[model samples]
Target: MKKIALIFSLAVLLVLGLSTAALAATNGPHGGFTTNTASCAQCHKTHTAQSSHLILFALVSGSQNDIYRTCTYCHSSTGSSHYDEVDGEIKDGSNLWATSAGGFQSMPTVEGATSYTTMATVSSKHNADQANNTLVAIPGGSSALKFELRCDSCHDPHGTQNARQLVPTVTVWNTLGTAYNTVSTIPNGAISMTVNNPTTNETITYNDDHINDFCGACHTDYLQTAVNSGSTQSGTYTSGLYRHRVGMAAAGASGYNAAYFALPTSSPAGDVLCVTCHYAHGTTAAVSSTTYANGSTLLRMDERGVCQDCHRKTFSTSQPAVVAASSYQVSATDKNHVVLAFNSYMEKVSAQTAGNYTVTGTGVTGVSSAQLQPNGVLGKTVLLTLNGSLTTGSSYTITVNTTTVKDLNGLAVSSTGNTFTFSSK
Candidate 1:
């Protein structure tokens, strides 16, 4: 019995030793550690001890903080030691290159340059943010904002190559219904092109998406753009209209809108490009409380303010004014009014019997006075039916008001006027 116990103890000890060895191997150099790949060492260094943080990269000359250099090393196009050129232009163009066709005064350029005639502004272009690494709050103070432009944020460098270096595939909703859950695979539309490095003859395919997909990924206002361009394209907008002018004209009978093609369809409008509204880098928000305190990082102002940069009138003043509802109550058993289908034989009461009168107001339009039917000689009665799910014991007010309300046709109430009142039954 003693000999058997000794053998069991040795077996347990061996098992624990093997477990520890496996755990270390999973995390240690020979097992999983890899260079030319993403790892903690890719961005940080431990043994050098030159800087307090011991970052792998050197410090930027003019920046006050250490993190600035880490980002500028890869982002700054002019000073970097590693670079390639395509045709006469730099392969990965300088960070200062203009991103827009119609340039703005505030966009950044190579160190001492005055303006970037090529970059687009946020109001007109779709590009990544490269300005600063200051955290801001999302609207409604829901969550802290992301400040840095990391490789993983927009691209998955380790995953399979894709347009824009996207990690996986893109999918979008297809229809609307109560359950309204359907999606369709977005086809791969991006490709890479080989550019001949005149000196070395090395070939590099710069991965990029079709012009429309490149811009649409970030700029979600595609439908609005289509409407402005007078394109009769159909999309997922509430009005079933495509709002942008970038993508292919939606084909099939279901996607076409006759009103959008008032002009000849053959003469297509100008294509919408990615740089139409944004700068690749170097625009900053003002320090004002109204603009910056609630705005996004690298954004000049709040979304509403950015929208106003192009759509000045839509947000400037309230048009298509709406009347505020002063009071309302819901009751399952309370009396309410109703309108019956049109019938010519029904005696339409006039002002002589004002007591048993029909009431109308601007509160709800599309309900014509002619549709109202009198209950008796005095009290205008309306049959109210409660849906089964409505609360049984609740109380409600049935209001009736008389005022000259116009319809969609712009017709006013006849001189007979209208009535308004509310009752709790």
Candidate 2:
């Protein structure tokens, strides 16, 4: 009777094991220990163990790192998967496949190539190799821990709840502190993906929380709390510049027009995220262009094309006009100083022409100079300095003549609302 009871308990345990495997992610190509327990043998050896982490691949000389060698063995162009992470190309049955996460630059031909070919150097990217690459500490973070970065540093092959199997907690071996530090992203929201193959459409949705804070796991002080609120620089970074807000709703943001956007957002309300503009793996975007430099900051688009996704200042079909309600404010300290705000991005050469503006009022002199604020690149505010101060309690009229001021697209400012009046302090 006791032997029969033991057999019954064993059967129950077997059923529970199968149920757990059914719930795991179907990452079969990566040796996902799911329904088929035999998949574990693909990456692990019980008796004849090799390198650290029980990895089956024997350590080769001149390899970047242990885990990288293990992953690229099946992820590179010559590997079984043909998802060459080195060159950021994927092979879908002899055809190149494209994914949201773009590819990297440097790639090797064999398991242990003597020298690597430098195709192109991406301006910005996460360090995946510690042996042959320079170690860059986490930005916005002040941790004094020195460590080696690997591919598995941010990804978990066993499968996870986060999108793309991103591990919730990252463990780094600190060589300086002689210990291990684990950065966590618990209590934050989840980022998920939905692929509709038949329709050839894919949508990524951010839930209640965002990925900005998830990336904040290592980027300690880059947390953005509210929409339109600027992120404060803490830790080591001391740059006091106003920055764009992330991890917040993008639909109702001041400069963002949802109708013009081609990116996905959170359900019900879309929130801007870190990955919304950047590629996690790497990018080959250009760093210099006619309008701007420093463009290749691991962005998904070339130059500032990502900025045009929502700003749309250069894409307006209507004539450029002054924003009356938010413009024409007299400075409290100096009555001669005033500000005028425009609705569209203006042409620097046209907007900064002092002769294009006229000031007429009591005790007011002619305009001295007109300068675009924020150094004029994509700036909409014009700061005007007057020749003489305006008397307090006096009304003044500022006129922007027709065909004088033009938008970035060379559209002249509208003639109807070209005149504005303001009362001096």
Candidate 3:
């Protein structure tokens, strides 16, 4: 009888062990994770086949239309919806989820409509025929390029904890500047996860939270350090002046003083975050076709599109000249036109002897003859130009103990005066 009882207990133990192993195997690698879908099903019942694939509790039905059906599930024009909570504007009864319905209908669907393909309009900026053009293979025949935009291209239905359900570790803004107070969009450097296949005994790594890395996968230029890395900056990339701060922090982050956005030293967060300009889903702001409105070179709204959100003055299309001048060093303070030319003949007329000119201004009481070629302009301006009998490639020097010259504004020279040696180029 005792032996029979021991055998029964052993059988029970074996059955339980096998059951636990089977359960573990069923879970595979990404086990013990409850997805957001469970939470989404609270208000929605999956009675039909189509509803089973959707988050029924979504704010609206998914079978409505291409634009409305999918978006309205979580977003709404009124009530306590995600769209309303995010300060999204509602047009007519529906919010501008993807494109402006009214504006889209107003324009002719065919070629006779307006040429610009605004976000609010039905026109598409991309040339569909060109999308399938030949792919140029890289050196050594590694891979070919192709383009497509499916529903998954811009969204992750998994529901991210971050606003807009964004992928992890992305930077939306990089530096804080006169126009904005944020750093370049940089991804969080750390944070990782993994997936495993029980049957194959294989594991795959995933980084769900690194912001910049995720956005860089699509917006390639934002990932580039050198301009030539892609099409956005290519020939236009320049240090300190022309480049946009996409992935770097302002200059003062590490006590370095370069040309970068300024940030408060006390702010605990150090780098720019990516969600700054781009909505992980979409936006209703109208952009230009050639620049940001249609699409940027990197398929972004455009540099001006991003800039205009914070700087309205810089993106006015009607005033092209006004907008262009403000984007560069063409401001009133920039002295591009303040020039000075050395009149060698006038110097000779004023000089008592050749190779020397008289000094008549304040702090210019030198009794000796002036070095006409170089001494006529001694630190009088930030930059100087010499024009006269001084041939190109001629070397000269200016010596001044304490002399002051007037600028076009008639202001006395206030900067330190040092001997500058240079040959006309």
Best by TM-score: 2
Judged by whole-model lDDT over C-alpha atoms, candidate 3 comes out at 0.28
- Each prediction's TM-score versus the true structure: 0.30, 0.57, 0.32
Local distance difference test, each candidate: 0.29, 0.58, 0.28
Model 2 regions lying over 4 Å from their true place: 1-26, 29-36, 59-63, 106-123, 132-134, 177-179, 195-208, 231-242, 289-295, 314-425
Q: How do the residues 200-251 of candidate 3 rate in per-residue lDDT, one tens digit apiece?
A: 2222233342454555554443444442333343322222332243444433
Better of 1 and 3 by TM-score: 3
RMSD of each: 28.0, 21.6, 26.8
| Candidate achieving higher TM-score, 1 or 2 | 2
Best model number under lDDT: 2
TM-score of 3: 0.32
Q: After superposition, how far is residue 275 of candidate 1 from its true place, in Å?
A: 4.2
Q: Rank the candidates by lDDT, best first.
A: 2, 1, 3
